[model samples]
Target: MVLASALLATLGLVSPVSAGASKGVELGASDTEGVTTSATPLRGTRGVSSYEGTGVPSDVTAYGAQRVPAGHRIEGYSSPTGDDFGTQSIIGADGRVRVDPTTSFPARATVLITRTVSGVERLHCTGWMFGASLVLTAGHCVFNQSTGWYTGQLRFYPGANGTTYPYGSCTAATLRSNTGWTVDGSPDADYGGASLNCSIGNTTGWYGAYWTTASLNGTSTTIQGYPGDKSQQQWIHSDQVRASNSLRLYYDNDTVGGNSGSSVHTVRADGSSGCSGRCSLAFHAYGVGSGTHNSGPRITESRFNLVIGWR
Candidate 1:
């Protein structure tokens, strides 16, 4: 899959606010609500309908970030081979596979996001339902860091399978992100939430979020999202957490450019909510560069509360 080079906008930085124990920085009251003019608009062409960047798994050469932490050793690094490493595979070569909502837990809760950059250029990203009317995603998906312009008119599709919109779609009424993203341009602050005008969450349900500092060295982490390379179809990858920090978690799941803002969670062993597992981690965003992993903004107690309030 060939991708046209994107025109990156200059990231505008603002005064950073205190973020407490997490590396995430909070924005002032004025900057915390609604889309702002300073946000980098998420970009795409009028004809461009799919994400062209590379996604998870170590060998794929996607446009997405793929840097793991320094010296982080992942378990599946032995005979690296699959889908040409970066050949636009929706699921990664080694362990990724397409998911059927009827068979996967928390799968229907994952939703697809659509928006018009600057109100003309249409683009899409991945997000998860977290409340009756709230969805969570990467801040960059709503506010581009390079462009400094907030996107316009968000449309969400829950349980989206190919051209089928099983759970229907809704337009976002509000887009909120941290001040570090719109003001300071910090990736650590790369999380955003949306309030939907429709009540899809009541039909499909949502996930509860949490954060922790305990070592997740061997914990199962699963990511499901609508990747652009797969024509905006949903896909899934399950892997173990590789490393973490104050504001991020690292894994080797197969993700791509469109998978940004996906929910990276750990499925519970006993299963609940009529599904097999649930998400208990972070929101996936960047692929580690020069590293063998993908990363997401780690959810903190405060961050959890922030999004929960929106829900």
Candidate 2:
């Protein structure tokens, strides 16, 4: 739920308990620091998923098993149209509950981001591991398109739940995103990744991404992130997909500001040998088109192939 229009100052250095955050601060990436990133558009067909996996992971250890069916769709959050999509209830507010440090595959893969804006401000966002050294997140979290500058120092805390940092923290060595996001601030192209200076993924492992042209309308989806409203602790929510186009997937999940770049995934039986039960589906980006309901850029062929190239 980043309010890029708010024109807030950028921030740096994340605290375990909302230590460096300001009151009345807007939730989203600040228009502060960011270095220009150079990336070529991954050459591939748009709107068509062209990954190598079975699309549905057979044996992912990310979650248990699939809970919903395909073609699952719902209305936007608090939509004036109707309540057919279901309502959002606070599962936890103080960031005390709804944490998943124990069943720690997806949660373990999730990471918290701290950025310094304009040399003085500090902002927070979320990301998840996609490679031994690559952490995926929202492009704006790394490059502030509004200011045409990249973030100044970027720090990542992996498997961070509450005050504990299970796998330690690392500074970003490199940040990457699509050329579109870097130039025009296209929300449809908001995905980004960070190459860390450490090997935290070797210990925690990373989730494998899957993409397909098949409908994800009814498949259950889960989103995980460290929201500013929840004291910047890791929060998890499980829900079903409401709609999907080539660019995005819509769902009703509890999300707030600071959740930009959170991973959108499907948990269930992947049926693959040694598979955990999860598949990477999308990357969360907050904005107007996203509205009140939780939505993200659906993992397309280009994004999938690019991420695989990182490995």
**Candidate that scores best on TM-score:** 1
Worst 10 residues of 1 by lDDT: 45-54
Q: Each prediction's Cα RMSD?
A: 16.3, 16.9
lDDT of 2 by residue, 194-283 (tens): 887766665555665566667888888788877655544677777778878888887776676677888887754434321234566788
Per-residue lDDT tens digits for candidate 1, residues 174-278, read 888988788988888899978777665655556645554456577788888876655445778888888888788888887767788998877553323211236
**True lDDT of residue 13, candidate 1:** 32
Pick by lDDT: which candidate is best?
1
Assess each prediction's global lDDT (C-alpha) against the native: 0.59, 0.59
Q: Give the TM-score of candidate 2.
A: 0.65
